[model samples]
Target: MADELVKAGILSAPEEIDKYYLHGSGHFIGLYTHDVGEDPDNLLQKDMMFTLEPGLYFPEEGIGIRIEDTLLVTEDGCEVLTADIPKTVVEIEAFMQS
Candidate 1:
């Protein structure tokens, strides 16, 4: 995903990567924001809940963005519980105007 972001010109330098992920990528979202969970090395299983949060931060530009979604692991893939939220720039702008 970081590679894609860089390719799209959303990120300027590879050095910015560390600033974006100063904390871990994401964590379990049950009971608490950082719920108890096994190590990420464990295989994902059905019904497991987690937060998929990717961020980009540019302190020099005073810009920071983070998109987060709760996911439910399934047999084949995962389901985004926060699908209704507006993620794209157009969608977010439209939502704000409404």
Candidate 2:
């Protein structure tokens, strides 16, 4: 994401990566409601549920964009629990107009 931000000319240097982008990868979701977070050393195994959210905040431009999705790890891969919902700028705008 930092690389992409750099390519888009959002940041002049890699050192300024955290100036606007706040927050970590995401948190775990369970009966505990955010307990048992993801461990960097361990790979996500089957049955683990979590969220993936990547956001960008540009206060100077008065705009902040965030996209979040819930996922469940499976034997083959991960299942996007929020797949049914509208995402992307076009999809969201169309859904809102409807």
Per lDDT, the best of the predicted structures is: 2
Q: List runs of model 1 lying over 4 Å from the truth.
A: 5-16
lDDT of 1 by residue, 1-98 (tens): 66766888866865556756556667986777789776778988899999988776777788887888999999989999999999999999999999
Best by TM-score: 2
**Candidate 1 vs. true structure, TM-score:** 0.80
The 10-residue segment with the lowest total lDDT in model 1: 14-23
Q: lDDT for every model?
A: 0.82, 0.85
Question: What is the C-alpha lDDT profile of model 2 across 8-86, one tens digit per residue?
Answer: 9988777787877888767789888766866757898999999898787888899987888999999999999999898
How displaced is residue 56 in candidate 2, in Å? 1.6
Model 2, CA-based lDDT: 0.85
Model 2 deviation from native, Cα RMSD in Å: 2.0
